[model samples]
Target: MDRLIYLDNAATTRTAPEVVEAMLPYFSESYGNPSSVYSFAAKNKDAVTGTRETIAKILGADTSEIYFTAGGTESDNWALKAAAEAYASKGKHIITTKIEHHAILHTGAYLEKRGYEVTYLDVDENGVVSPAAVEAAIRPDTILISVMFANNEIGTIEPIREIGQIARAHGVLFHTDAVQAFGQIPIRVDDCCIDMLSASGHKLNGPKGIGFLYIRKGVKIRSFIHGGAQERKRRAGTENVPGIIGLGAAAQRAARSMEERTAKERELRDHLIGRVLAEIPYSRLNGHPTDRLPNNANFSFRFIEGESLLIMLDMKGICASSGSACTSGSLDPSHVLLAIGLPHEIAHGSLRLTLGEETTREDIDYVVDALKEIVARLRDMSPLYEDFVKKNRQ
Candidate 1:
């Protein structure tokens, strides 16, 4: 059997063997609830605290500021909801972008139902929201501004530092959904003036169902989960002991190898992009060419539906995605692509191939060759392509 090529890191990454090793102990020998008062549980409790410190160091945040949650979605929901409730008196208005993951977009909608106002800023053709646009959208009643550090679909990194500075100047809390950017890029909360940030373990080669939110010191946000004191009483409920251990180990590894890993991935990603665009006619690369994530390469193939392409890739043991994993089953075209000014037909034809630490140049070359064949085969069967060719020839 041929080696499987996994190019969907933006959806989730394979858990590192080292991370799995780190987590093994807690599932059996060290299986004690962190909240228990007995001596057996004390070790697990300390492990949770120690892991928090490890993640805190990665984000340049204090240990007290990190709050654990289920994953990125939960962290995002918590951040936006907490901010809206905390600052309701200051103003009920919130600022975000149209290209945000549904986590933020849906949360904003929920907030609006509860009497909060949300202003969604528009992005450029490359899916970049300007800090000036963010500032202009800010009203006197605006209490919080939330933007993702990087888009999950297009992979365009946002100007978070500039936006954070604007939020600071206006005395409004700034939060970024850094789930897609946290381990992939360097993020210093203090340097960026970020009040809050979100991250998930599965996005960075760690165990699933564990993530953390970084809340800057002195931020007056309310508790997300209301239960027995956990996460320093900021987030409640018993902690997932093994998952936290795995996340800490993964975070440590990612921070240590970020530069080398990303450089290699970027090279392979560029190679794939170049080959796909050159070999496949009528294909266009999406997102900012230079400002995109080191591992992501999204494209739109004219007249070919992304799902059909994905199905063909799967048969060849290749894994890719049309858009965000959370929105996989939706029939509608990607909101990110639409927000970036793509027509509905073009948006529906988008493909997202995100590289990872395990991805190799050989794997990329195989995927590109497979893609060329698949796109060509699909286009041959497409009526749109036939009509396009006939119209152009005439």
Candidate 2:
């Protein structure tokens, strides 16, 4: 079988071998309910605690403040819903950017349906929301402010620390969907002045089905899941032992290798972006050049559909994504791309190539060469390209 080049780390990542190894014992010999009191469970419980502590330490958060959830979506839901309910008496308004992940956007919409007022702030062409915009959006009735640390599609990193400061001055709770930024960037809850944050394991080379929400010590939040005494009574369900173990291992590795990994990915990402834009006709970059994720490279090619490009790339043994994997099946252009001021045509032509630790320079070069061929071929079949050329020549 031929090796396929993977460049969709933003959608999800391949689980690290070390992460899998750490999870193996929990799924096999060490299998036990962390909530159980028997000796078999006691060992599992210790493992869970250790993992929790390790994650907390890495985030500069308290162990009790970290509530494990199923993944990023659940964590986003919990944070938004809990904030609305916890502060309903004080206010019923929430503010968030238009470019946030669907997790936050959909949850905010749900809150709006439930009688809460939501303010969707607009983003710049680079897909960045200004901190001042968030500050100005606050009202006397504002209860919380939610924004993503980094965009999943365009890879624009928001000014989260500044936004957090604005939220703090307004005495409003702040939550950031850090699923795309947590392991890829340095994040200190206190330094950022964030009240709550959400993360997923799979985005950071850990196993899927496991994630966490960081709730500040004094913040009051309602539980989304109701069940036994688990997750400090904040979240309820049988603990995902193996997934959590994998997440812990992934987090540890990320912490230790972050600087080196980031440098390498950035180098490759920038090289790919440069080469693709230089080699492909009518191609433009989609996000902030310097303030974006080290692993992300988004581009728009004129006169070709993103899905068509993805299919052609796959045929060349290169794996990439047109946009968010969740919305890939839908015909609608990505909300993130639209929010960045792209026209429908350009938005539909966008492609996201996110690198990971396993990605190599050779793989990037292969993708660049393949994309050059595919885009040229696709453009030849496009009536829009022919029309434009005809008009320009005349």
Candidate 3:
């Protein structure tokens, strides 16, 4: 690993040095419980408040609306489950996209077993869900609509504002899992008409194990975690003072440099996509061509498996993924690719390369060169590729 290149920012990012520096003091010197009444711990409470304010301002939300959680998983779970419980009297019907992360999908399943009806809407070939379809699926009993702001696997940005408008017009609460979209793009809760949103800290160069759920005022959601009065009595347990500080520091840094950072990432991403598509035969890009995260470029090289591609890339000091980091280990192809109408063989060969602020044109070029060789080697060993070549020659 003499020349290491990390292109898996969507999976997680290296915490910024500034974020670490801000959190260090909270971990040691001023780490008293925020819940404590003593003046010594007052700073901890103030720190949490300040972090909440910083995060809320970024999303155009009120400070009281942001509730800290363990991470995106917890925030997503809390949003769906607690909303289901609180709104049960209104209706037990919920609507969501099929391409959502497992946090939403698995929680939807949990709700289904508890006697709720969930409609998993399909997306287009570009992985964009139609707002018309969402409106069409709306029922008198529909209580909530959960959609991801941007897809975690393919990096496709959904038509969230349109969907949010539909939800609002239907008098249904809308919750977006903004885990991948928060730091990468601009979002305004009020402008989008989003009633609730979930975001994680680690995705944006913040420390892991910290996230927040934004519940619009008067959304009427109940508590998910049962215990003390933390998170304004919505989520329970002790506050993570260090995590809060880190999340704030990361958020501020991301805001100040988002435009410049994403511009560079987008350029690098397109360069990677362009070179790979031109240099490699039978390689297809996944997700929307333009309406995607600036840092994301996913592709499927026919006649090669994703795991083998990842292994070869690792050998070349490159890091990437086949799909969502949470589900990359599964044998089945990505549901996102399948949803976008990719066949099993092609979907099985998908590769996801998510760029970061540190990624450069040199890095992208190196990855493309490695991929060209890797795909050629892998296909050379494939009997299916041989059969196709023979048939074409005939």
Candidate 4:
């Protein structure tokens, strides 16, 4: 284990060196509270404000529309809960896809417990939610529609613009969990009709404690935390000034390097997929092939368990995931895989390898060679594969 090859960028990325450097001053030298009204604290306050404007500009949103939060979970929880509470008079129903991250799914379930009716729409085998199905699910009581901009597990980019259009036509607030999509892809809130969007800093080479929620003008959702007048009185707490600055720095870097970075990633991603499918037995690709994220490649191999594969990869100094890092503890087959029509067995064998900017062609070659050996070894030990081989011989 002289070296580590990390392929789980969707879980979280290593903070960029430049972002870390940008954050250093806020920790010691400029360690003044942004909430402090003194002239001495103005630098920290200005830094926070400037970071907000930076994030807002990336989303094509107004500077005032962005509200900083602890991370993606808080932003998502705030969006769904606050929207339900704020617009309760209009309706008590919501719409979302079955393939959403647990942040969105769990919040929907909590709302259901509190008397909100939720419609969990199914996706096609490629993990694509139909905008028509979303429209069909809308009822007179439908008040909100929350969908992820991309599937965290499979990396299938969703029809955000189309769904956003549908929500707008019906006067429903649309919120997208852009935790995986932000910084990795181009998203213009105004162009896509996104009323609310959630993103995490850690997902894009920034500090883990900071994230932002974009709320369209006039959409007055209730405040998430309730102690101080931070985040324009919308979210309460002392700002993580270092985290904010780090996130801004990361956002700028991601935007500046997106085209070049993604081009290299897409080339490597395809190479990895091609080698795995061609060299391995009983392997199938997951997610939409062309429509997926440039840096993601998920696969399902017959007759082997995902946990076993992950463990073996770990032994070889490689890191990967069976699904999302959030739900890695769960024993049940992924609801997302089930939503996309995978049986429990095949879904149980899922492997998700999301690439990062630091990944190299040599890295992918190493991973592919490792997968060939691991999958072959795992399948050899399986009774299912043994039976299949005997059947073919007969």
Per-residue C-alpha lDDT of model 1 across residues 1-394, encoded as one tens digit per residue = 3779899999999999999999999999999999999999999999999999999888778898888899999999999999788888888999999999999999999999999989999999999999999998888999999999999999999999999999999988999999999889999998999998999999999989999888888888999898878888878888999999999999999999999999998899889988988888999999999898999999999998988989989999999999999988899999999999999999889999999998888899899889889988999999999999999999
**1-394 per-residue lDDT for model 4 (tens digits):** 9679999999999999999999999999999987788977998999988988898888888999999888999999999999999999999999998999899999999999999999999999999999999999999999999999999988899999999999999988999999999998899998889999999999999999899999999996998899988888888888899999999999998988999999999999999999999999889999999898889999999999999999999999999999988887889988888899999999999999999999999999999899889999998899999999999999
Report the Cα lDDT for candidate 2: 0.91
Task: Estimate the TM-score for candidate 3.
Answer: 0.99
> Which candidate tops lDDT?
3
What is the C-alpha local distance difference test score of each model? 0.92, 0.91, 0.94, 0.93
Location of the lowest summed lDDT over 10 successive residues in candidate 1: 1-10
Among residues 3 or more apart in sequence or in different chains, the pairs in candidate 3 whose N, CA or C atoms overlap within 3 Å are: none
Residue pairs that clash (backbone atoms under 3 angstroms), model 1: none
lDDT of 1 at 335: 94
Q: Candidate 1 — number of clashing residue pairs?
A: 0
Ranking of all candidate structures by their lDDT, best first? 3, 4, 1, 2
Distance (Å) between predicted and true CA of 350, model 2?
Answer: 0.9
lDDT of 2 by residue, 266-367 (tens): 999989998998888899999898999999999999899999999888888888898888776999998988888889998899899999999999999989
Candidate 1 positional error at 231, Å? 1.4
Regarding lDDT, does 2 or 4 come out ahead?
4
Global fold similarity of model 2 (TM-score): 0.98
What is model 2's C-alpha RMSD?
A: 0.9
Better of 2 and 3 by TM-score: 3
